[model samples]
Target: MNQLELLKKFTIIVADTSEINSICKYKPQDATTNPSLILKAVELKENRKFLNKAVEYAKKNGGSKKNQLTNASDKILVDLGIEILKYIPGYISSEVDARLSFNTEECILKAKKIIQMYEEQGISRKRVLIKLAATWECIKAAEELKKDNIFCNLTLLFSFAQARACAESNVFLISPFVGRIYDWYVSKNLISTFSYNEDPGVTSVCKIYNFYKKHNYKTIIMGASFRNIQQILLLSGCDRLTISPVLLKELELNNTVFNRKLIPPTIFLEPPRPLTEDEFRWEHNQDEMAVQKLSEGIRNFGKDQLLLEQIISKLI
Candidate 1:
């Protein structure tokens, strides 16, 4: 079996793309999208129809310019998610606006709105996972949403503090970004040596996975932002791995036999106590890499979201 086929035996392969064509090509079980990916997709000539439809819907609703743009943006986000859903048999993670990352109330309201949009089109909430940044407020928002049966995927997770808090909040899943963490270490020249197994990104996910499994937490650990196939291979037994098409293609072509690198340890380790809001903040603050990346990720996603609105404005 090719590496992709073998990997599937131990992990659910999720296509991490905004392009419908890429998801269809890879045939992953699930798919994920963010503002950045959606922005890229909206710029594509083939995806212009979707953008036009969103603009039209927003115009018909007849609201203020800001409301129209906001409505149009949400419409397009759900519309693209609905389109992508047709190609995948599993859930599609539609992210909330990154600008709301720090606002729990806004995050919950937006998540409900997205879910309602999908429901209006005959799609059930089970097929949708609201993607939120792993801010404490967002996690609290997710906690409330979970009570209402809305599932969440916490993204932009960079440290164990974030992971622990996410698990404690009973999030549906947490995406501990592998490649982003690796990128930070590399950029800082902090690592004197590197290997797939020793890659900071790989190590981060492993630690999260072990912690989750040790406590038997139901919250899934889906490793995201892979820098290469090796990182993907290193995390073969993670709850799930959302892979970009580039790495997916490489795995499909390489006929290498690889074993699962991560498995729940038979012995449970001592579980850490749940963190308070202040503790969570201080712990996150202490991890310079996590603090920098989390801030950067939100800023970058928020910027793309604005850029996407610019494209929609032209259509309007």
Candidate 2:
């Protein structure tokens, strides 16, 4: 078997793009999307149909300009998710508006809205994972969302504190960005190249994995945003790894032998006392890399979201 098939024995592979063709070709167990991916996908000629449908949904709803645009923007996500669900049997991760990342109430509302859109289309809420940024407010928001049976995938997760907080909240999953963290270190000229064990991104996820396994935390750790095939190979036994189509193709072509590196510990320890909001903030802030990346990630996603809205507005 090729690496992709072998890796599947341990980790659940997820397609990280909004492109339907790639999802069909690679056949990942699950799929994830963000505004940047949706923006790129919507621009493609083949995906123009989804845009038209979203625009019509907004117009038929008959709201103010702002309300219509909001509805249209959300419609695009639901439309894409609904389509992806046809190809993959597992859950689809649709992220909330990045602009609402820091607003707990807004985050919760947006999450519910996404869920409602999916459910209205005859898709069960069980097939959807409402994604949110790993901000303190969003984490707190996720805690409440769980009561309504809304599972969340916390992105922009770089610090261990965020992982701890997510576990405490008992979120369904957490997507730690492996590539983004590696990119930060590279930009600083920290290291040009290194072995898998020395890679900061791999180490971060491993640390989180061990923590969860040792303490018997139920939250899933899906290693995402990989930079290379080696990063994916190193995280062979992660709960899930979201890969781009290009890398999936590479994995399919390569017959490299790799071992499962992550295994659950036999003995479980009592989880530590949950961290207070102040502690999570302080610990997360102390990691310069995490602080900068989380801010930049939110800003980048926000920009793409505005651009997506603009594209949908033109159609309306």
Candidate 3:
């Protein structure tokens, strides 16, 4: 079997793209979209119609065409998300503004707004997973959103503490980034071959997976941010994995045996060690890689979000 099929044997493969055509080609069980991905898609000739329609719709609905255009962009994003969802029976993840990571209240408010937008289009909460950064404030926001039956997919996760905190709060899903971990190790000159068991990213997810399974947390684990096919293959049997289209294509073309590398329950039968917020904060504070990357991820997402808003404003 090709690597994609091999990975499928062990995990639910998600196509990480906003391009409907690319998603249709891979037939990923689930799909994820970020502002960055959506921005990229809107720039495409084939997908430009979606943006155009958004502009026209906005012009008709509001104070100015510009204001209308912004609304249209938001509507178009939701429409594009719902359109992508039509191809899969599984869930589609749509992220909120990374800029609001520190404002739990704003995050909750925005999440509700997005859900309402989707519902207005006949999309149900079951099919839409609101994505948020794994900041403490975002986690608290998710807790409130979860109470409202709004499921969440916590993204930008980088450490065991973040995973543990999410599990404790009972989130719907957690996306522990994989490729970013590899990036850290590479930059620090820590890359080394393992006997299919010691890849840093693989080990990171395994740690989180075992913790959740052993403790019986219902929050699903979805590994995201992949750099290579090996990283995806190594994480087979994870609850779900979101992979880039380029890597997904590589997986589909190569013949590589995929195996169940992570069985959380069997692997983590011991009781989960308890963690206080103080301890969690301290642990994360000491992990330079996690601290640096989490900050960097938030900054990058925030910058892109700012740029997107600017683009929307100009068009409005």
Candidate 4:
């Protein structure tokens, strides 16, 4: 089997794009979008109509631009998300604001608001996975949202500790960043970072993947933020992976053989022990890498969100 086929055994491939057509081409089981992807889509000449309609909806439902509409950006964001979902067969992960990552109540409220908007558009809760940062507050919100039967995709994950906490919480999915991890290693080592399979980011994901498989945790592991094909191949057996279009096209062109590298049955020998909020906190505090990555991920997402807001301002 080709590498993609091999990866499919243990991984559910997810496209990371706002272009519904691009996602259709790869036949990924699911798809993911963020403010950055949506921003990129709005800039594309072909998606102008999508952007325009969202703006129109905002005007009608969001009131005037001078008097900001509560959750207006989220409304538009979800509208665009619904459009993207039309082309895929699986769930779409829509993220909450990075700024709200620290507020459990606010996160829950925003999540409910988004889910309501989706329902208004005839989208079922099952088809939507609310994405949130893997902070303590976000986890708390996720737990509450779960009780309401709303699934969640815990994102900005960088450490085994973060993965452990997410698993303990029984989140629907956890997106462990692969590319950002690679970036860290290279930034720290410069040119030497180009070495073959020794990428630290790839190793990090493997560790987390094995941990999840060993414990047989229900929380699905979805690796995200890939930098190159090498990282993707290294994580062929991960539960799911969100790949950018650029990388997706590269995989199609190469047609490399993919095989399941992670066998949970082979690796996990102990019973699963879930972590508590305090246990998660202590573990995260000890994981310097997770702390650094979580902070960096938030900052990066926050900057992109600001840029997206600026773009929306110009459009309106």
Candidate 5:
């Protein structure tokens, strides 16, 4: 079996793209999309139909231009998500706006709206994992949404504090961005790269994995934002791995065999870390790389969201 085939034995392969066609090509178990991916999908010729439909949707559901654009943006993400769901048998992670990352109330309201859109399309809310940035407020938002049976995937995760908060909140899944973590370290030190065993991103995920396994936290760990096939290989037994198409194609082509690198450690009873709101902030604040990357990630996604609105503006 090729590496991709073998890797599936360990990790649930999730296609990390807004391109529905690629999801079919990869045959991933799940698919994830953010503003950046959705923006790219909006420009694709094949996905133009969804964009046009969203414009018509905005027209019919008339509101202020800002609200219209916001609604249309949400519409297209779900439209793409709805289409991608047809190919993958598992969940589709549709993100809450990064701009709303710090607003607990808004995050809860937005998540409900996204779930409602999927339900209206005859898709079950159970099939959607509402994605939110791993800000303290967003985590609290997820805690509330969970009571309503709306599961979430907390992304932009960087530090142990973020992971602990998600676990205590009982989030459905947490996507610790692997490659972005590695990138921050490399930029700081001006290094080319680290080997898979020593890679900072890989180590970060492993630390969380061991901690969760030791504590028996049931939240799923889906490693995301891989920079290379080796990073994918290193995280072989993650609950899931959200891989970009470029890296997915690379894994498909490489016939090299690999072994599962992440296995849940045996339970060793210890005090569970249910980080308080202040503790979460302080602990996360201390990690310079996490702080910077988390902020940078939210800004980039927020920018892409605006750019997506611009596309909607021109089309409408």
Candidate 6:
């Protein structure tokens, strides 16, 4: 069997894209989208119809300029998600606005609004996973959303602290970014001499996976942001993996033999004591790479979100 088929034996493969064609071609069990992916999709002529529809909806509803912009942006995102859902059989992760990453109340409100929009279109909440940054406030917001049966996928997670917090909060899923972590180390010249197995990004996910398995935490770990096929292969047995079309195509073409590198521990180990809010902040701060990458990810997503809004504003 090819790598994609072999890997599916142990992990659920998720296409991480906003392009309907790619999602349809790969036929992944689930798909994930963010502001960046949604923006990229809107630029394509084929996808512009959805954007135009959203802009028209926002204009007809008529509100203040700011409200109109926000409404259009949200509608566009949900519309893309709705389109992608038509191709996949499982969940599609829809992210909250990165600008609201730190505001617990705002995150909660926006998450509810996205779900409401999906529900309005006749989609059930079970098929949608709300994506949020791993900020404490966002985690808290996710906790509250969980009570109402809204699942969440905690993104921008780098440090173990973030993973632990999400697991403790009973989040539905956590996307520990493998490629972004690898990028940070390579940028700092910290991994000048490392093997694929020793890749820092792979190592980070391995640590989190081991912790989760050892302690029997139920938060699903879906490795994301892979820079190469090796990183994806290294995490073959993760609960789930979100792969870009580029790498997914690579896997589909190559029939190379690869074994499962991760397996659940036969015996459970004691989980570390939960970190307090202050401790969580300090621990996260000490990991300079995590600190930098988390901030950068949020900023980049926010920038793309603003750019998307500008595109919609012109249409209005």
Instruction: Work out the TM-score per prediction.
Output: 0.98, 0.98, 0.91, 0.90, 0.97, 0.98
lDDT of each: 0.93, 0.93, 0.83, 0.80, 0.91, 0.92
Give the lowest summed-lDDT range of ten residues in model 3: 265-274
lDDT for residue 310 in candidate 2, whole number 0-100: 87
Per-prediction RMSD in angstroms? 1.1, 0.9, 2.5, 2.5, 1.3, 0.9
**Model 6 CA deviation exceeding 4 Å by range:** none
TM-score of model 2 relative to the true fold? 0.98
| Cα lDDT of model 6 by residue, 1-316, tens digit | 7898899898999999987778888889999999898889899999889888988889988999889899998898888888888889999999999999989999999999999999999999999999999999999999999999999999999998898888888899999999999889889999888799799889999999999999999999999999999999999999999999999999999898988989999999777787789988998888898899999999999999999989998989
lDDT string for model 4 (103-163, tens) is 9999999899899999998999999999999998898789789999999999988877788
Assess candidate 6 and give its lDDT: 0.92
Report residue 12 deviation for candidate 1 (angstroms).
0.6
List, residue by residue over 1-316, the lDDT tens digit for candidate 5. 8899999999899999877667888899999998888888888898789989999999889989998898898899888888888888999999988999999999999999999999999999999999999999999999899999999999999998999999988888999999999899888884566567888899999999988888888899999999999988998998999999999999999999878888877657775647788888999999999999999999999999989898899877
Where model 5 places Cα greater than 4 Å from the true spot, the runs are: 190-193
Candidate 1 colliding pairs: none
- Any residue pairs clashing in model 5, and if so which? none
Q: Given candidate 5, what's the lDDT at residue 72?
A: 91
For model 3, residues 284-306, the per-residue Cα lDDT tens digits are 78778788888899898877766
